[model samples]
Target: MSLSPSTLSPPPLSLYVHIPWCVRKCPYCDFNSHQGRGELPFAAYVDALLADLDLDLPLVWGRTVQTVFFGGGTPSLMPGELIDRFLQGASSRLRFAPGCEITLETNPGTVEHGSFKAYCDAGINRLSFGVQSFDDGCLQRLGRIHDSSEATAAIKLAQDAGFDNINLDLMYALPGQNLAMAESDLEQAFALQPTHMSHYQLTLEPNTVFAARPPSGLPDEDGSWDIQEHCQAMLADAGYRQYEVSAYARPGRECVHNLNYWKYGDYLGIGAGAHGKITSGHDQSILRRWKLKHPAAYLEAADSERGIGGDELIATERRPFEFMLNALRLVDGFSLTGFEASTGVPRSAIQAQLQEAVQKQWLLVDGDAVRPTALGRRFTNDVVELFLTG
Candidate 1:
């Protein structure tokens, strides 16, 4: 059942658990998040999450989970006890690597009454807070529930609770946000001294409220680039290195779970709207599976085959584009040998595309290592499109 001639080896495995409920959905968010009406079904959702994982367990039978991330809607909303219960069940079914980086994405608004210590005790070593901006007006414009002070207090609370490996999520080029306001946000984040930071420009995603009705006073392309350039310089001066396009980290603090993803590793994604990518050595093939998106429907179908929303097998021709989509995002880029191992396709398949990119000064192929040039990184889409159409 192999699709390509290149030998394939499974990479590090991670687990992604998606929580679909949020107190209030942000207008700019395009993720599969829904606003919670009343009390959320925490207990029932935990049960369903475990059930979903059970169904997907066979895909990685003997594999050890190298990392675990509880991504959200607002994972901070789920109480600690239930998270502990889910971890217990999962560890029993599959092996977890020692000192695995288990992260929970926290909404600053939701963490106001939450217990960070309880989460720490539940084996969550890392916390990523959604603190989009330090400007209250910008926060309001983005429909974020947490104001500037709340975001600061939330990080302090996590810090006091002994969370050293914290990540602050920030966005720039918001409505009514100027270069100075964006600098202020970075300054505030630097004071927190988080292990990592995810900084990116805010764009209107389709189907979202912002996209349907665009926000007023949004920064133009040049303005956004100015903000990005200044903030990146500030981050570097503050000891945060730009590892990926949007991700920055202190030395040795890069997110392991996300690194696995960037390296085209294996992962089991369970919970509503969660997507999983697995590489099977038995068949030398790759499988991508996703669960039902709606919480209610996913809850009802969790323990059954009906929970699966869709599955896609990677065709031999599509491997290069798929591999480049993740691999090319890295600053250091990937090695030729690593590419073949991950994609199960020979390097010769992409030689023409590689040569073209090199000739155009878009990529630098130094021996076995291939990395994007500054010009290419700026036009990453165009560089990736070469492989897409190859």
Candidate 2:
């Protein structure tokens, strides 16, 4: 017998493997990554990750994996043999759909060209390098371990390793940044010729070093806005498509793993501090799970039946907000049908507020989708607030 609509499961899945250690944490970084010393237990970590995936297997049955992303403090730091072992172990649990996108995130200072090439041979088809800036002073201010020259070399090395699908991560609105300086940073990134670029504006998030002791280099509001606008234009002129607020790509080089997140696709996150949202309908219910943070704690608890710290089942009311928060980040918002398909809710649920937003000129109303107007994107907090009636 065919499953009921409520019993229908999410489509082909994705996996996110988190590596929690970095050589040193940047002052502006607020991710769950941590700084460490001494030698790493690569073999042990790989075993733990596979064990974690084994616990998640029931949710992955019959679903082919379309993508795998190795993200973290610095995935490139893990020896190539460990990456291969991890992939081999994952394959035994779930089958990969043909031509799946496999990605590894690297920092310019960590791995050399030989190691990058080894990663490619180990089944990493894409490389995303953290090359925040090409300005020496900006690099130093950001506490990046790599210099401007090293950043350039890293990109060339990836290319030499036959990684045509590569991405560079850059940050603008940094401390002591001016419009001219930001432009120069973009210019250097363009010269690298990576298939994709993610240019994020630096924000002083709470609990970060910048928040505790305000830095001297951050721009004023007006200055920050100016820098963002000009940089967007620069990227556009350089043949990059601004697909999302912070992501740009050449033709078809957009990161599939990221697109999955934006479209509300299901993912399994493994490793310390990693959070996952899974939409499974096995028993007519959807569930989400999140693992604990702190590597030491996770490692200590890996043998248990449930190493995760928390799990939440999303309800009808909360799902729309979660869906829109991600979809709207795209320059062109998702289709109305996409909303229904992804959220399992009808368009009528949010139509009234959507109409009101259009009337106020806060959103652009296309027939099946809605997008923020320039003004709306500028005041995104207000736009999102209009949807909060609960």
Candidate 3:
């Protein structure tokens, strides 16, 4: 069953531009990132991105993008001029809402003397630094190119560049990491005074090098849980609220682009290996699309119909599970009306699951809003699994 247009008037839109090159690939990273060969095809890639957006323009012609995120592989590695030109091209072709939160992801190793300032001047209002750990030993163990010093310097440089809205990415439960080490890492990160922090536990994802040859001294489940709990307490005491599972922010500093994503809003994805979701106005059908993964193949098909690797109409039966996959990540959960509007799946569709979850002490349903209880947040996977259908 398809959704009626009246019930799906569309949600706020965002834009994601993927840059698929990195100095070196991390052992645990499974993102679509290729190590830099001799020189990056900056000009060709930018042109291809614009062409890709042009092809997707019809799907979001009249909509104003509320946020733009330049993610992956280290977008800061690109020259500031190319970044500026790409944003200019996107602006010329699409409408950007006033005060749009434009973000760029970078790593500590990629920072040059003036690159941060250049990117800021190019209209990137927010910067997310990939500072996996502040421990030099852990950094080396993780195969990270940047050391603890570089990570510290990078945050200082971004602050000096006049970027107040900065996010530091830190990881816990690393190889040989103990509770004290985790606390020290968080202390170092907090000392830098970043507006937002994404504290993630390092897990060996499938198809990655680490998953094949696991590292030694990796923390067990109990150790990992201890590290997470202590660090979360430290963050809370320091005035950073845990808005999502791994994301913490000071008041009014939560990532707008990510919030839109967690809310199941619409976003246009361009560049190699980027994924996008759109709610079509014509029929109110929810569609998910993606581009070619390899840079060469993506560039070759940029202007062709094959530029899009695949597109599919999300089945109505699957919409509830899909929506909960993202929405349940939030600590506050979601409202029934918002969920219905975003997924076009009525409350009744998931009523049985909700009732079961509440009975299992995994969720608390208070009138219109349904949120995970403290126990539910701990076993979020189980809570979300309740919505799945056979």
Q: Write the per-residue lDDT of candidate 2 for residues 216-329, one digit (tens) a residue.
A: 968998998899899899999999999888999999899999998987888999988787878766554457887878898888776565578788887766667777777777
Q: Where's the lowest-lDDT run of ten residues in candidate 1?
A: 1-10
Residue 323 C-alpha lDDT in model 1 = 86
TM-score of each: 0.98, 0.95, 0.98
- Candidates sorted by TM-score, best first: 3, 1, 2
User: How are the candidates ranked when ordered by lDDT, highest leading?
Assistant: 3, 1, 2
Worst lDDT run of 10 residues, candidate 3, spans 1-10
Runs in model 3 deviating more than 4 A are 1-5
In model 1, which residue pairs have backbone atoms overlapping below 3 Å? none
lDDT of each: 0.91, 0.84, 0.91
lDDT string, candidate 3, 82-136, tens digits = 9999999999999999999999998989887589878988899999999988999
Name the TM-score of candidate 3. 0.98
Q: 291-341, model 1: which lDDT tens digit per residue?
A: 999999999999998999999998878888988888888888899999889
lDDT measured at residue 229 in model 2 versus the true structure, 0 to 100: 92
Which candidate, 1 or 2, has the higher TM-score?
Answer: 1
